[model samples]
Target: MNRTTPSTHPSSDKGHSVVAAPVTAHPLAELIAHEIRERGGWMGFERFMELALYAPGLGYYSGGRRVLGQRPQDGSDFVTAPELTPLFGEVLARQVLQALDATGTDEVWEFGAGTGALAEQLLGELGDRIQRYVIVDLSGSLRDRQHQRLLKAHPSLVHKVIWADSLPEAMSGVIVGNEVLDAMPVHLLSWDGARWQERGVALAPQGDTPHPTFAWADRPAPEGVRPPTEHPDSAYPPGTVTETHGQAEAFVATLAQRMVRGAAFFLDYGFPEAEYHLPQRHGGTLMCHHAHTADADPLAMVGDKDITAHVNFTGIALAGQEAGWEVLGYCSQGRFLTNCGLGEALARTGQASNAADIQSRVALQMLVAEHEMGELFKVIGFVKGPWFEAIGFAHGDRTHTL
Candidate 1:
C-alpha cells in the first residue's frame, strides 16, 4: 500500500481548508443528496457514513471493486491481516481452539468476514473442531466472493460455514472481528473552543458544478451527548474534531448480550483512553482510504473509498464490561501474536516446502514488526461463559494500564 502525508492538518480540516467529499456519479451519492434534502438540509455524519459504506447495493463496501487485497491495482482500498497472509489466521486459530474447548461449544461466529479469507484459513486449520461456522457481513455483495473462495479452498468444510444476514438470537462459540469495529459508523464530535457540536453533512453547489456537493454542517451536540474520552479537549486549540465510537461500542454490547456461552475477540489499530485522547492529538482520528491513498477528508470520497477511524479500546472494554462480559485482556498486535505463537509460526516456515515460504515469512514480519502493524494494532478479548484464559492475551497485557 502506498502512503502519502496529506497536505491539510487536522486543526484546519473543518475550517477554511475543509476538503470536499469526492463528487461521483455513483447512485450512492444521489441517495445521500436525496436524504439531505429530505432531512431539511442536514444529516448526522454517522448516518451519512452508514449509507456511504453499507447501503445495500450502492455503498463502497457492498458494491465497489474488491475491497480486500494487496493494493489498489488489485481492486482494493487496503490490506487486512488475513489477506496479507494465511499465517495470521493459522496463528489465530490456536486461540480459537482454546476458546472452543473452554466454552465446550462447537460453533464459531465471525463478523465482517471479507472474502472469507479468515474463514478459509480457520476452517483449514481447525478442521472438524467446529460444528457450524457462521459468517456474517453487512454487504450481501461480498457473499459471492466469499462463497467462491471457500468452495475452492475448503470444499469439505464449506458445508459447515453458513452465511447469515444477522446474528442468531443465541450462540455458543468464539466470535471474532478483525478491523471490523473501525468500519462501524462513528459520530463526529467537534470542540469549538466554548462548546461541542455534532458535525454533519449538507448539500450545496460548488464551483461550476450543477450537481450538489457535500459540505460540513454543525449543530449543538444532541442532548446527553457526553464526551468520548475522559480529558475531552481541555486545552486543545479550537476546531479540534474527533470521533466517538457509539456504533462500535453498541455492537460489542449487543454481541456480548447475545453470546450466551462463548467469548469474543477483536483486533484493530487504536489506543487506550489516555493515549487515545492525548492533548497532543487535537485533531481527530477520522481517515479515508482510496486506492491505498490515505486522506483526512472523508467528504471527497463519497462511495468510491473506505472511511474509518481508530478503534477506541477503552470504549470497547467499557462496553463489554457494562454488558457483563469479562475483560479478558488487551495488548498490542505484536505481543498478542507472539503469545499466540507467531515466533514459532515464522520458524516453521523456514522448513516448509511451499513455494511462497519466504514471502510468507516477510508478510509475518509486516504483521508483527514493531515499525509496521505490530505496536499500533491491538487485540482485546471478552468472555461471557466461565472465563477460560484467552491465550492471545496471556502475556504483556495492557488492560490495567489502559
Candidate 2:
C-alpha cells in the first residue's frame, strides 16, 4: 500500500504540458494514498476527512502549519474573525449570556480555538459571569500563546481558561464552535437516477497520472438515506453525481452526545436543505483551499492545503435529534447577530465621542453588513434544558423548511 505522483507527457494535440506540478510531499498524503490503495483505490468522504484533519501527524489541522483565523502574516493563506479583534468575543459574550441564562450552566467550552484569540476576548467579556472557560483544540503549540493572550486580554479571567485535548466527562456548559463544522470531512455521493455511488481518489495509470486523480466508485448508498429526488429517464445517464454527508451527521452526533445536557452552537457557512438539494447543484460542494485559492485539486498542495465541505444543516439537525439534543434555533449568522443585539451595539459605538471610537463602530459594522459574511454563513444551536425561544429564527426572511 504505497503511492507516488504519476508521470504525464506533453499533449501532441494541445501542444501543452499534460503534467501538472508535483504535489509537495506530506506524510498525510502518503498515508491516505496507502490506505486508498489497500482498500482498492477508493475511500468515503468521511474517511477522507478523518485522514485529512486527524491523520496522526500529517493532516491539515493536525499539521504544524498555522492557517486558522485573522493573524496570518504577509501572503499567508487565511484568517478568521477571532484574529480580527477582541470585540468579536465581546459580541459573543452577549450570546453567551443568553446561553447561560437559558441553560442554567456556568461553564463555556470553545472548540477549534485557533490561536486562542476568541477565547481571550470571550473570557474578558465574560469576566466573573462564567464559572469556567475551556479551550479544546489539538494544537498544543498554541497553548502557551493562548495563555499569554488571555492573560493580557483579561488578567482576571486568565486562570479560568483551561486547555483540553478532548471533552470533559459529565460536562454541562454552553459549547461554541466557530467555523468548525465546515472543516469536518463530508461524504460526497452521486445520484445516478437508479443508483448512488461514492466518490474516491485513485492513482492514475503510471504513464497517464499527473499526481493522484479522483473517480467515482460504485458502492451501496448510505443506509437509511435516499436520493434527494427521483430522477427518472436519462437525467443522469447512469453516471451523474450528487452529494450527501454521513460524516457530518456522525460529527453532529458526537457533539450532541458529548453535550449530554447543555447547549451547543455551530457557526459556519452553508445553505439549508431547500437550496442545498437544488437540481442545479449537481457537481457538489467539495472544495480545496491552497494558498488562498479555492479549487478541486486536493493533491495540489498536499499537507499545506485545506479541504472543506458546506455543512448540511438538515443532516446535522436530524443527527442532533437522534442523539437526544433538542434543536432550538436555526438561522443565518446575520440574523443571529442582529437578535443578539448587534444593531444596538453598533449604534452605541456610532455615537463614539472621539475619532478612535468612530473607527471601532466601522469595524463592528463590517461584521454585520449583509455584503460581508452576514448572509452566507449560518448558525444553528441545540439545547437540552429550559431555554427555548429561537434567537435567530425571529427573522423569517431567510428561514427555510429545515
Judging by lDDT against the true structure, name the best candidate.
Answer: 1
Instruction: Estimate candidate 1's alpha-carbon lDDT, on a 0 to 1 scale.
Output: 0.82
Checking candidate 2 for backbone clashes, the offending pairs are: 69-80, 70-79, 70-80, 189-242, 190-242
Cα lDDT listed for each candidate: 0.82, 0.65
Q: Give, for candidate 1, the lowest lDDT window spanning 10 residues.
A: 2-11
Best by TM-score: 1
Give the per-residue lDDT digits (tens) of candidate 2, residues 1-402: 000011221111111112332554566666777788998766765686667767766777676666654323443355566564456667767877777877778899888787787787777677787888988877565566677777877787778878887765567888898877777776656555565555545544434543443333446566755544444424543434445667678867887777756788888777777677565555566666654555654545566767766777877888998987887778767678777767776777766788766756665665556676666677888888785675545664343457
Per-model TM-score, in order, reads 0.94, 0.83
> How would you encode candidate 1's per-residue C-alpha lDDT over 92-201 as one tens digit per residue?
99999998899888998889898788999999989999999998887766788899999999887899988887777877799989889989999887777767778888
Question: Which 10 consecutive positions of candidate 2 have the poorest summed lDDT?
Answer: 1-10
